[model samples]
Structure formats: structure tokens, C-alpha cells
Target: MSARAGSFSFDRKDLSRFLFDLYDYEPKLLRKLISARPYVCPFEDIERHIPEDAKVLDVGCGNGALLAILLASGRVKVAVGCDVHEGALASARMAAERTGNAGHVSFLKIRGFEELPADSFDVVTMVDVLHHVPEGDRVKAVEEAIKRVAAGGIFLFKDMVEAPFWRRLAHNVDDLIFSGEWVRQVKTAKVEAQVKAAGFELFESLEIPRIFYGNTLRVFRRL
Candidate 1:
């Protein structure tokens, strides 16, 4: 699959090749994990918001694909990935080491948002994660994610939003079958309100079109 955002071309095949080059010598298990979960969005889309020499924290970092990309781009000074899955964390560590980013990036096994330190990272990212959070804890999760962002830092939130009837049905069915759980449709207005209540100023809210469904990427700055 290929996606173009401005001058950037996001080709899944090319990203797969890059991952292979980085993980070829690694263990078979790690290689398989990286191959299974390719980049979800174009690198340029995410890279543009990250400043040079910034400390980054990626919540729900599955297999560390995004973290590795950020570190490899040479724009990040320190990258930390926190996830609940042990297998994913292991793969993330291996990917970082293989890509020569182990020194700059590290993965932590965390149970929830409460474990993260407050105001520590310059860039905080939660990509495709909010929906996975339980309904009762979603708001708390977002608040914690916001708290991790330092003053004047950016919080990048990307996830699937409510779509049309047919599109939403397909999206939910796909999620149920593959993820073994119902996909919660995220309401953009509700999320924005939560961010605003937390003292974050919404700087950008973009809807990027995709083949099957659309994604919303919002950038917020903590005041």
C-alpha cells in the first residue's frame, strides 16, 4: 500500500524492506513481529512534528516500529516506548539494538498511564491507542498522556474516528475479528474537550484520508 502526504510517499513495501534491513540479523521471533505490524502511517506525517534533539515517549508502542523510525530519523535525542505486552517490549528492544538505536531508545513494560512520569518528555505520542483503552479509563489515560508532555511540548494523538455507517461497520468487524475485541469509535469532539479541559491548546486537527477508513491526527501543546 502506498500513501502520499505532500511530498512524502508512504509505501508499505519500502517500509518493510527497511525493517528487514534493520532486523535481518536479529532473532527470528523479533523479525516476524516487525514484519507483521508495519508502519500504520507515513513516516513524514509523524516526523514533521518531532523537533530535533527532543525526548520522545510513545505510549502503547506495539513492537516499537514507530520508536525505531523516530530514532533512525536522527531527530530524537532520547526515545522511550511503554507497552503492557512483554513480547512486544522484547521485540522493541531487539529492533532498537539492531537499528543502532538501543543507546537512544528504551522500552518499559507498563500496566497503565499512572506508571508514566509527569512532564518528562518533550514529545508524547499515543497512536491508535485510545480506543483500545477501556471505556471507563479512556479519559484518565488521555489526561495522563497529557501530563507526560512538558510545558510547551507537543502531544500527538492519532486514532480512528467515527466514520460513515458502512465504513464504520467494516472497521469494527475487522477489529473484532483481528483484535478479538470490539473497536470503540472515538468521538473527536469529546477528545478535544478533554484535551482542552486539561489545559492543552489544540494547535492542529487534521483528517487524513485512507483507502478504507480515515484517521484523525491532532497536535496539542501544553500550556
Candidate 2:
């Protein structure tokens, strides 16, 4: 997938350059950040789904990298990002400013899903976030996320699914050591049920292939 900035098409090299320029980080550090855990999805896969002139809301948007990318593409009219982490919001604000798309995007520090408005965005995205939510609250959280999508808008959900025994063991161990929370692998069926319960119909579903992560990508359309 390629992003159009005015007339120029942005490739993977352009994405890397843009990120580096936005963060002003050393090349080695930037490489590590890009290749590290929790940021494994390729930009191309996400970019492909973004429509021109879209208004996007990214829930749990750490560092606003994805929002920055959408804004830089010149395809998004408005990009709103929210995260609970103050550090993440600070980084997101800095990145948006450096990318020169600060006017097109806004970052908010939110405590929970209740702070977001309903029917406000053409595209609502949650990347690697659902699994991190407490299992008992997952349904309510997803329902709240769906409410942010405008009529006929899309909700894009991406998260890791259960893996084979060895991979699952390694993933659980990594989560415990690095994130300090036990990773709850929610079944895709349960997620689908939640979305359906929220009055959204399944639009598309696919497996996003990534090393060290078994990810599922689903797109649901609000009726």
C-alpha cells in the first residue's frame, strides 16, 4: 500500500524517513523501535484500508505513529488519537508537530472509552488493544468503540490470537516479563459476537502474518 502526499506516493522508505524525521531519533534506536514488540504490523497493511478524505479515530494510539502516517498521506481530513498514557500522548503530540500535520490531527489524554463521542468518526481503529483490556470489560469496551463509528463507517480491530503451544508459551512469557500483565488470548469467535451484539455486521476478516505474533484483522461495518 502506498500513501499519497499531494502528488508524491509514499513507499516503505518514505514511511521510515518520515518516522525518523518526526521522532528525530538515532538510526539504530529508530530501527529497534520499529522492529521491536508491540509495533510489528507493517504500515502498508494498515494504509491499504484507509480511504481518501477519511476522518479517523485511533483508540489506544501509542505515540500516534499511525495517525501521523495517515495525516502525512494527505488522504485523511482529520486524525484523532487517544491514549491513557501521558508519555505516549506527549510523544504523539511531538510527532504530529514535527510531521507538520498538527493542524490535521489531535491527540487527547483519555481515562477510558466513555470520554469519546458517538458517531464521530468514519474509521475507528483498535490495534493490539483489545487483548490488553480486562476480559470481563472487553465487550463493553468494544461496544463503546463501535459507538464512535458513524453510520456505515468501519471499525478496524487488530490483535493477537491464540498460537500453537510453544509460540503461546513464549508469548505469555514475554508479556509477563515486559508488560507485567498476563496476556489473555481472546478467541476470535467471542470478539465477533461482541461486534455483532453492538449492531455491526462483519465486513471482512483476515490473518495478518507476523513473526512472533499471530494477529487477526477484522473489519466491521456499523449498520
Candidate 3:
């Protein structure tokens, strides 16, 4: 499959090749992480749900890979990613420049919620971020992310699955390596209920199970 708008074009067959080229200059470790990302993450699945020509915001957007794909494949008009890591932000900025997306893409260092723009977006996504958040802050973080979704906009929530004792254990190791902390995981049911309580209606729910890593995805529409 392929998509094009303005100057952005993406061919599904070229995703791997594109990513390989995108991070070719990164260090060995980051290159490996980026290369392994498509295999381990449900990016294609998530990409299909984002609307064309949408204005997008990604919370806890590590490395900005998802934002990059949306810009390339979904014809997103503007994409912004926010995270606390400067190194990742630098890499994201480099990728945007290399792709000639600097005019349409931006990255923000989000030390506090007040740093985010007050404007709502057409699409708001938080992938694999809730689990990394401290247990006490997850709710507030979710609320903040949801608040950025404009009325009738979509909120995409994707996070590691927390179940099957053995799988959870494997994910813990994965988290430790990536996040450097043992994070608390909330059940999928609870997360869905929480979002539903926050004036969102669940539009779709998916459970993607993998050998080492699993994911739970919820697509919600602002009601």
C-alpha cells in the first residue's frame, strides 16, 4: 500500500527500507532499537486508524518513530511529539530535517504539562507510555493526553499487555532496559474503563500478542 500528500509519500513495502535509511547515522544501539521496533510494535495497526490530513500530537513520543510514520503514510498535515528525553528529541529533529519534514513536524521537550500547547489536535496518541509513567501519575497523564483530543477527535492508546505471568515478566525486563525502572502495569479492562469514564467512547479494542512482547490497543472517540 502507498499514500502521498504534499511532499510525503510512503509505501508499505518500503517501511523497513525507509527506517533503515532514516536512522543509518545513529549509534549501533539506537539503530538496533529502531530496526527492531517495527517487528515488535504494532505500528501498522495503529497507522490505519489515524485520519488523513490530520493534525497530530503524540505524548511520550520516544524517538518520534510513530509521528514520522504518520507524517509519511497518513498524510498528516502537522505532527508534534513530546517527550522528556533530549537525546531522542535530537534524533527526531534530525529525522524530520532529513526527510524534509522540518516544516511540518516538531518535537517538544515536555518537563511539565504546562509546556504543551493549549490547542487541541485532530489526533492524539500515547503509545507504550502509560506503563512507564509512575503509578501515581498515570491517571493525570492520561487525562492530560485526552484533553488534547479535539471534540470528535480520536485518542489512540497503546501499551504493553499486563497479563500471563510469564509474559509480564518478560515485559518487565524489556521495560527495565528501555525505561530503566520497574513500572507498574494496569489491567486492560481497568484502562478501558478509565477512559470510558473520562467522556470517551471506545470505538475499537485490540489485543496483540507476541512471543516476547504483547500490546493492548484502545481507540477512543471523544464524546
* Best model number under TM-score: 3
lDDT of each: 0.76, 0.75, 0.78
Query: Tens digits of per-residue lDDT for model 2 on 1-223?
Result: 2223564344555666556656665356654464343245656666677788899999999878788777767768888898989887888887777656688888888888888655489899998787788888888788888889888888998877676666566667767875798888877788899888888999888876556656678888889
Which window of ten consecutive residues has the lowest lDDT sum in model 2? 1-10
Which residue pairs come into collision in candidate 2? none
The predictions' CA RMSDs to the true structure, in order, are 4.5, 3.1, 2.6
User: Model 3 over residues 1-223: C-alpha lDDT tens digits?
Assistant: 2223344434433665666677778987778678677767787788878887889998888777777666655467888889999999998887766665567888999896546667899889989888877777777777788889899999999988777777788888887887688877766687788889989999999888766878888999989
Worst 10 residues of 3 by lDDT: 1-10
Candidate closer to the true structure by lDDT (higher is better), 1 or 3 = 3
Q: What is the lDDT for 94 in model 3?
A: 78
Candidate 1 wrongly placed segments (more than 4 Å) = 1-13, 23-40
Query: What lDDT does model 3 reach?
Result: 0.78
Residue pairs with clashing backbones, model 1: none
- Ten residues in sequence with the least summed lDDT for candidate 1: 1-10
Clashes of 3: 0
